[model samples]
Target: MMHSFGELVTKFTSYFNVRHFPMAPSTLYDPCEYFLGLGGKRIRPVMCLMGNELFDKITPDAYHVANAIELFHNFTLIHDDIMDKAPLRRGMQTVHTKFDEPTALLSGDVMMIQAYEYINKVRTNTIHRILTLFNKTAAQVCEGQQLDMDFEKKETVDLDDYIEMIGLKTSVLMAASLQLGAILGGAGDSNAKHLYEFGLNLGIAFQVQDDYLDAFGDPEKFGKQVGGDIVANKKTFLLIHALDVATGAQKEELQNLLKQNEDDKVEKVLAIYRSCGVDEWARSLKEKYVTVAFQHLEDIAVLSVRKKPLKELTSFLVQRDF
Candidate 1:
């Protein structure tokens, strides 16, 4: 029943394709194409268009702006892969790992520039507003990434701090995506602001869900290594919960699990996490965020018909497997 939002995005992307590269381009173009071609949920752009449609019709004008969001997101991914030293993106070779770090860096930079170029396709006034939003979101994303990296070295990251970090690192772009869509579709300032809040809340919930999935999800349905966050020593909800709840030997065991280098490290960590009830704690946290997200959606004040597709899209996003 059209479970994949990327299917809609794939159908729409052909129209956004533009030819701007100089002849016989370097390897930079290859990484751009490689990462972009390896499809994703396209939740951001779809929300953009849906936001636009809430105020006006979806047309070519909307596609350019929506596509810019996609470009900007991919730009972030390429740089993030390098920063994370991640070997795979969407289950395939990462740009930095497949090519080289230098190539990936240059390609990521080009993608950022290309994102601007895509935004410029809109008219002059829209370009000004869109670029302003894009610039702010890009900078904030970098800030968020830095915070995430910093948290890795830290021992006491609170829930509030983590939320703020995700807000900058992940949620702002989503807010911008919806605002851009609303702006493109001729929404009033109030409506645009509300749509942005909706996107922000949804983004937070989606990220929290990712954390829950890392520790509690069925691997067959989730389509990745379970307890991956634990294995990588990533600070996720499960880890955070354990930090808050475990005491004495349990704390020591968790700490030891975090430090251990073994073949079944993830399995061992999950066993401990389950025994400590971190899984249930994390699940409750995920649900809390999801409830808040839907509350924001309800407060959007748009007509129900206008909001239906957007709500459907958001439901598909947070409920999806992997």
Candidate 2:
């Protein structure tokens, strides 16, 4: 019987919420435990399960890989919070903020090692391929994060460059997660590649939606401060597109706004975005990527009935108000 997304999410979470570490040194393990306790949607790991189920029955290897993907994803979040120096995650103190930086770093390190331990539990036949893909994707994630940092320093970032950075930072892991599950489910290489493409485009679309929400969403529903990205001058698709399409006084004003951290900054910038039709453009850009993602999903040689959950997931990712 095919498992729905909710069924798999319940299955995965039950398995994940376990005694994952020894209780000797409270420093490292405590931070790890705290961060994991800050629950998320667990999208990547569940996507792996969905990938596996799409082609065939979920395998023993898929669970192991799904666990690994969840661990690895959390590992990145721990480090990312530290690197971003974010004080809060899900309204709780971050690992680095609650604990020390050194401890947080080590917590991230141990979590990554534990992820590999889970990876090693997969079947012997698929172990090598899984490791290769996971490793490559991990490296790419680091590289993408570096590019995100580097982009913050540069004066002007091209649209293509920003897309490339997000593709590496946010898209690769999702793609790899799905592909890894596909391989474990006995899919051929071509089908695996199609699933990866589906994931990649969907990931990009997800990021676009997230970026849009940061500017346009209600603070109450969004669960984060509106205009956080704008106040920080982070290069996002909307800001980048606004710069591209804006002209004359609007262009000059936009350039000036980027240099300051003023209170009215978000309002002024969003006004410019609206003037340049950036909000509309962002919606369509997200739709463009979503369209491509769905096409790739359609190409995966599976029965249509098996694809319902992914399509629902894709819709939810792109259409969320929060």
Model 1 earns a TM-score of: 0.91
The whole-model lDDT of each prediction reads 0.78, 0.91
In terms of lDDT, the best-performing candidate is 2
Report the Cα RMSD per candidate: 2.7, 1.2
- For candidate 2, lDDT tens digit of each residue in 118-211? 9999865888999999999999999999999999888878999999999999999999988998988889988999999999999999999999
Off by over 4 Å in 2: none
Candidates in order, TM-scores: namely 0.91, 0.97
Task: Give the clash count for each candidate.
Answer: 0, 0
Which candidate number has the best TM-score?
A: 2
Worst 10 residues of 2 by lDDT: 19-28
lDDT of 1 by residue, 1-322 (tens): 2223444566566655544354347576877787787877676787777777777667566677777788889888999999999999888999998899999999888888887777878873677787888788889999999999999999868978988999999899888888888888877787787778877877887887888787778899988888778778898766776777777787888788778879888877777778888767766776676677667667766776666677677767677666
Report lDDT (Cα) of residue 202, candidate 2.
95
**Residue 250 displacement in candidate 1 (angstroms):** 1.3
